[model samples]
Target: MKYGYYPGCSLERNASAYHESAMEVAAALNLEFAEVEDWNCCGATEYMAIDMLPAFALISRNLALAAEQMGNGRQQQLVAPCSACFLNLSKTDRYLRDSPELADKVNQALAAGGLHYKPGSLRVRHLLDILVTDVGFNAVAEKVTKPLYNLRLAPYYGCLVVRPVRKTPFDNPEYPTSLDTLMRTLGAKVVDYPLKAQCCGGHMTQIKEHTALEIIRRLLKNAADYQADAIVTLCPMCQLNLDAYQDNVNKHFGTNYNIPILYFTQLVGLAFGISPKKLGFGKEFVDAAPALKKIGAEPPPKAKKPRPSKTALPMPAPAEED
Candidate 1:
């Protein structure tokens, strides 16, 4: 019931709602999350490409910290709510165990801080993996105060969660059903999403705008084509690309899609009878009020002035100066 929580960069900023809702859900399920002390960034998706040894060393630092926290001898069950964090940590752990040379190099870097990580000493996992495997859907369904009746949701797992099949043996690489099953457990009708495991073009939007839009376009178009009310996601990167750049996708394709990309944990929080305000509901660029109305979930309190049109949402800009 206890886990070492790793709320990566996104959870502290852009995907704060996911972190909020995840903590809310964990509390309701009687799960305890002790955040890893002095955890660092997992180098995200871009850092690895920039430099390999540094990226592995950076990611290893977090794993080393998590293992150190499990002072009582058992392998630490470190869970991350962000997909990028999960992939980086999980991949780092795997690579470290698989390659002794790499493991030695990472350990040497850690020795500078008087820390040395033993590969395979920490059980790195995603929040979704814990919920489905450890918490169980039946237990989740039992706690639902308000089932998501009649809500047709597309469960978008995106690429990172299940890709590189060897990493996530439990999930099908081509089409995973864990998210879809989780939504159904909340009483929402799960749409058959063909692009469920497709890439969200992580960092591609910043690198090649048009190319990223096309990749995002396919996912959005597929969801709309299936008549899904909204897209529920497990990854912050996926959620950001789909939700924040939605307008750009529309502009590129000349399509008017207002699909709300929501964190899967947010819906779980709703079913557990948590308030929208606590779940960070109104923070999304795309308003989810229209879709939530279908399930009778309370909308965010309205502002006196009208909300801006989707086009008026701040465009994706270059990284701002600190």
Candidate 2:
């Protein structure tokens, strides 16, 4: 199937692995993605909170371009691999369709750039939704040359994608199982992770270090408790938070967790027999090789580290009120 692609800013830089692996997996599945021309940022997770009109305008610009690019095509779907991008795009389209006043203002802003987007002209879908729903698990299973046998994965949805309860959500928002089902289709063991839809404290790691670390620590602890070999996520922000600041979380919480945070597409590529190097495997902060080795082999028993008693450690000092 052919669809318009929006890689978002994160995919071009910190989350390049997601883009690379997604491309390889797309090739394996005979999917065609034509990138939208001159696409801009999606205002990320906080831009809308800072300023509503500008944020919607910024997001709507991409929508306008996508609609123009896929004019009258059988498939007018624009796929975004980043969770924030998907939400921003989808939310903007939904809001514009519901609020004519807001759409008029956004279009007035777009008029300056010679672009106007009619709401609902194009369908915005997260990459995972398209992969699982459109491509179908059976088609994906047939393409897996190296099934991820024996690999235990905690599918982390990270509070986005299947959220805000859209009119036709592809998965359950409160407790999603699409990612879990996808991993199982690849022959991997899916852990029953309750915190799968919890927030990863997006951008909060920089705003509130202590609070963010605690959030990150809880997720790591839960996944570790389930004996998951790795935490596979669908969002770039979640992967960045849990993988980049993991050391800080460990130091602050007095925990010795060593769980690897990976993108779901990476495992999908691996299952399709793609080389790790080509899949952007080494870009992650945590080394995925150790967890990946568990596939098709009897991994040596993990060494248990003595965790410090929570009661013994002093609670983090409260943040001073402004």
Candidate 3:
């Protein structure tokens, strides 16, 4: 199956391993991905709230690129790895293409850039959608070389993946279980954490540290309470907020709840039988090595303990021989 990919900015830096594991897993599943040429940012959470048109236009710009650049203006559906980008890109494309007033306003802005987005020209899909609907869980199950039989995971939807009433079509806005289903396909024990779709407080980590930390703390505490080995996610912001800021959250709350926040792609990599080393398990700020080991996934076998330096004991032995 071929998918036109729009990786967004996070994939290039903070989430490079996501791209790596995604591509490798896609290859394993025979998924053909063609990335949009010279794509731009999706305007994330902040841009949309402040300036609606330009924000949508920014996301639309990438969608327009996806339609225009992918063979003589032929519309092509884009597969987005980040849930925020997926929702933003999909929402803007859908709303603009549907509402004439909005489209005219956006097109007026587009006049300067020589870009116009035609409605229904693009289909924005999240990585999870592609994994289940396109690739099929059974196919994913077939590729499992090492099933994660014992590990329990808390599926964190964050805020962006499912909400705002009407955008994505996968599952319930308040509670999403597709990720849990995918994890279960890999033989993981998925938990029913009611806070799955709760906000991780996003960039509020910068502007409102206390709020972000509180939110992050709750998610981690709940996951740990549910006996989760880690948290599985579909957004870079979610992964970054949860993974990178975990220590800070602990400091703020004066609690030590350590749980690895893993990307859905990394789990897919494990299901596709990729080694844990290539999956970037050790690079995570939160130590995932322990949880990974529970899945029988180790970091290159810890390099066999070096043999005792021969010279130390050899000196006395050689003297005796002499």
Candidate 4:
């Protein structure tokens, strides 16, 4: 299916691997993505909090451009690969549709640039949502030439894309499982990760170093606890925080955590038999070689749980039972 693609800012730089892997996987899946012409930054997560009108206008400009490009096409969906971009675009559209006063002001601002947008004119969707929902797990499974067997992955949803729940959200906001199911379809084992939907400290890393390190440490520690080969995520910000700051977190916490943070698309490309270099595997700060090497290898045997001692005291009974 054809859709308008928004690579956002991170995809052009630090998260280039996400863009590369997405394109490779899209090609393998026979999906056509026409990039929005002259798309600008969606203001990410900060601009909206600073100034509402300009932020919405900036985000709406892309929507207007995408709508104009589609021009009567049945599919007017605009896909943003970055979590920040997706949330900004989706939030602006929702706000514009809900508040006519804000919409008028945003349109007035847009008019200065000879552009106008009507909130719901185009549908804003995240890359992961579209992949799992529109593409279908069965279709994705069919393309897996080399299954990611024996590889254990913790699917990290971060906290943005699924929050401030939409009228028709693709996945559960509190506890999303779409990514988990997608990983399993590629033959990878999905670990039980409770913090999958937790925040990854976004720009806080730049503002408050200590706080950011603590948050990053929690995610890394949780993934390590689950014995995951890697933490797979759809958000560029989450990957940046976890992968880029792992060493800093280690230093601050005095803990050694070598968990690799990989994009969901990278794993998809790998399962489709794409080469690691082509999928931009080495671009991440944490070395993914160790985790990638375990893809087809046999899983380690499970350790037996220790039996309770016969001399141990009996457990206390509940007050009601007593």
Task: Name the best candidate (by lDDT).
Answer: 2
lDDT by residue for model 3 (157-201), tens: 877666653354777787777888888888887887879989888
* Model 4 lDDT per residue over 165-264, tens place: 4677788888999999999899898998989999999999989999899999999999999899999999899999999899999889899999999999
Q: Compute the lDDT of residue 114 as modeled in candidate 1.
A: 91
Each model's RMSD to truth, in Å? 11.8, 9.1, 14.2, 5.0
lDDT of 1: 0.87
Comparing 1 with 4 on TM-score, the higher-scoring candidate is 4
Could you give me the TM-score of model 4 versus the true structure? 0.91
lDDT-better candidate, 1 vs 4: 4
Question: Quick one: how many clashes does candidate 2 have?
Answer: 0
Candidate 1 local Cα displacement, residue 106, angstroms: 1.0
TM-score-wise, the better of 2 and 4 is 4
**TM-score list, all predictions:** 0.90, 0.91, 0.87, 0.91
| Location of the lowest summed lDDT over 10 successive residues in candidate 1 | 298-307
**Candidate 4: minimum summed lDDT over ten consecutive residues — where?**
313-322
lDDT of each: 0.87, 0.90, 0.81, 0.89
* Candidate 1 lDDT for residue 118: 92
